[model samples]
Target: MCILFATRSHPNYELILISNRDEFFERDTHNTCWHTNSSILSPYDMARNQKTSPTNSETFGTWIGINKNGRVANILNLRPADTPPNKSSKGKVSRGMIPFTFLNTDSRKDSFSEWDSFEKFEHQYPCLTTSGDFNFFYGDIKSKSYRIIDTFGQTFKVLDQNDNDSFVLSNNTFNIENTKKWNKTEEGMQKLKELISKTKNESNNNIILMECFKLASICSVPEEIRNKPYHVDPAITYDTIFVPPLGSNDGEDIGLTITKGDFYGTRSQIVILVSKNSKHVTYVEKVLHTSDRDCKTHSAINPKDFHQFEFEIE
Candidate 1:
């Protein structure tokens, strides 16, 4: 499972996100743009590759991605539904390609029309759900297009234009309730920071970043769930601080504070400080991971199988 948090304003984009993968895969890539791995055939890839139905197969899936054209796509796994079997299933589409395809094929101006096309395409292919499933949220800032597509459970919801705010989508559930409780933007940010801190560890840089992104993407916590204390065993916390670039051309600096099990791990959190006046990243802290015993095995949990939070960033 993966979570993405980002804020897009005109030409500038800020993103803090994380991706959680199942334990089987032991690789990570930091490519800026989206592309498919021809050698790695996931269920979605297989469907797309074979032009067959997605009944029972492992497929590629993505958390979030932003295209060079300023298009954005986020996907979450969802629960499979009980539909009548049909022989007319069209070729399936891979989830991994959604972000890249959305960004590459259509511009912001044509988002609405493009969404329609995607829906039609998926409906025909009809991916099957094992235990894993997913839903998608897509938007094109230039075109002012936004949509929510559920592949496994429930119907698609079209977000109102007024609903535009910093929104966070998480696994298993959507956190819309938290958005209503915070009276001030700072309060919300603090809450988000706190949430991310709970999931931090020192072992893997990607794992730590993924937890931070999950918190950053949150829009608000529901009142009912807000007061609830952490229940997951061995709760973790990590810190990520962003330092803006020094000069006009630099990117920005980021510092991470790592902690776990009510104790600071031997290795301090990594920090990535960007210099001012640089168009790209200036410096990155050393990568770290949780201890083997504390490190949880990564796995892909279907979007329908998890919860999500949608909030506004001030």
Candidate 2:
């Protein structure tokens, strides 16, 4: 998963996300783009080859999706210390699949129903390994809402609607406890807007957004265990920006702008725009120049395998 941009307040703030997954199974594969319908379960199946992992019987490990309902979710591999296995051999279900699956379902109430349901399901079909932790967040676009469910130790918190207008999801380490005080939705949004306006003159709005994500990406972990790969392997090291169309409406540009880089790597920009609202994307524009040396390294996953792809919110 590359980068995710979303907001609960502006339905027009349609999500703009891009992913470049490295797969050892397919050598010549390219980055593939997909459009998920109201239901995310189907897309999750198509995105992952369930047969590859032994835990497929319970859950397929993958960054499932973010829905237009302002619901953004992703599963991350937990650290070993964060999740110690039980001696009982009943097996554990893959917690990473919870966020993707929750957004796929139609449950509307945010009263821990989603988390409870996931827990019940995992009790039946356990996962293969129980070493890592599972982290998930759900946000409602209309209400400026957000909820973080750190299910390893019953850690759950909801962000107040008045404190934030938009929230970014990244593959970084962050302290769940410190974020509890971040329920000031309105203030957070205002600050974000100010930051964006101040940086908009930098020639690229996408770069400005990347800066916000980097700041929000701050994570907390024990210094001794920080070096250890606790969560998802090859954690998302790059950032991408999802720009809503120039105007605020649906069926608009559906164009997505993306930037890939880290604090040290070269950054390259790519723009995917939909010319026609047909079943598939028609126009894809990318910046000719790149600031990075490895900009030409194609992803192992083919971006064309998925079809009827467009980044617009219904």
Top candidate, metric TM-score: 2
Cα distance off (Å), candidate 1, residue 257: 32
Q: Per-residue lDDT tens digits of candidate 1, residues 188-208?
A: 345544543553233343454
The TM-score values for the models, in the order shown, are 0.41, 0.42
Alpha-carbon error at 189 in model 2, in Å? 13
Error of 1 at 187 (Å): 11
Q: Write the per-residue lDDT of candidate 2 for residues 110-161, one digit (tens) a residue.
A: 4333344335435533442341344455544334335554434343344353
**Residue 309 CA displacement from its true place in model 2, Å:** 5.5
How close is each model in CA RMSD to the real structure? 15.1, 12.9
Give the C-alpha lDDT of model 2: 0.33
Cα shift from native, residue 31, model 2 (Å): 5.0
Q: What is the lDDT of residue 129 in candidate 1?
A: 29
